[model samples]
Target: MHDQARHGGAYIRIHVTKQGFDPLTQRLRWSDLEQVLDTGPFPDEGPTTDDPILDGVSYSFQVTAPGRTGRHIVYAVWRAGHADQNYYMCSDVRFPGGAPDPTTPPPSPPAPNDGCTAAYTPPGQWTGVSRAR
Candidate 1:
């Protein structure tokens, strides 16, 4: 999903709900995951601006489901300035290729100690703010 601040700018953080993780009932730490982008105080107003600074910037990242598949949730938390207020949104996505066949047994969950971490590396540098048309 694509979004931008309409009034005061904000610092954005991205987080994904792990396959077995329950974001509704469980407490989530927004700082633990890697941030996809930090727009600082003035992010490009998406495609609405005539000469958007980050118009061409594209973000990509990989997610691991760990024996689970179907749909997952991604959260974007935008914290405006340094105030105590925080804004958040959720996007539900389905994995490619749809669900596994019913005849096929589901994969076993990994052992408690078997876990891995994935990091996102930005593909290009941000060119900072530009005059909005």
Candidate 2:
């Protein structure tokens, strides 16, 4: 997630549910929501102040899925410390249980100097997404 305006610290709340999100209504079926998977406050990597003109930050989390699972949706809400607004994102994930398959290898690490900047100007866009460089 990209904080374009360099807003101060923020809190991230993640909830997992079997409920699927509706694109037409822009809502999620909360009936299957049992509990929140994880929550964390951000700007943990550094301090935030109004001094700098631009402050961009990113955060990531590793959450454990339920043992018995088929398909699930993870919702993340980002609430800025100084703002009353909240941003939302939903991700669909699946867990197929059985023996682990060796054919599908683990995810590889991000390449060095991939153009992800922590502060200041926006980092370069994802490679090969656009025609213009």
Candidate 3:
């Protein structure tokens, strides 16, 4: 999905299962990055809809799913900057290679972010939006 730079908002596109879809061997797993664009600070789900901002920086998304015969297939992508990593399922990952520059400054503080949320398990921590995905 493309953000298209409308209202400085991000876009997300998920692919549903189609015919001929088959399960792999190993269990599938993925890491949802809260930050994608190199810019800092993330916006909330519901914003004022004014003075919207969109940075090009992005984060990495790693997916490992079962392959045929219980094997495992790993997929990773450094894309989806405009997509804001707004995903809820594991799928194939396509990318060039390697992460972009690591020195890019983070986006500004999130003006608002109602579009994202997460739970903190033991040993992990949960916080408010502070970066972009």
* Top-TM-score structure, candidate number: 2
Ranking by lDDT: 2, 1, 3
**lDDT by residue for model 3 (52-94), tens:** 3753233332322222222122222223334544333344442
Candidate 2 error regions (>4 Å): 8-10, 18-27, 38-40, 44-55, 98-133
Q: Root-mean-square deviation of each candidate, in angstroms?
A: 23.1, 15.8, 21.7
Query: How does model 1 score by TM-score?
Result: 0.38
Which model, 1 or 3, shows the larger lDDT? Answer: 1
lDDT of 1 by residue, 1-133 (tens): 3333343445666665555544333455554333444555644343443447533322233544444355556677767554556788877666554444367555555557656878765755435745567
Q: Give the per-residue lDDT digits (tens) of candidate 2, residues 42-116.
A: 653543446456565555567664653455677777787677878888886666743333576556555689777
Superposed model 1: Cα runs more than 4 Å off: 1-5, 19-40, 44-46, 49-69, 82-84, 97-133
CA lDDT scores, all candidates in order: 0.52, 0.59, 0.32
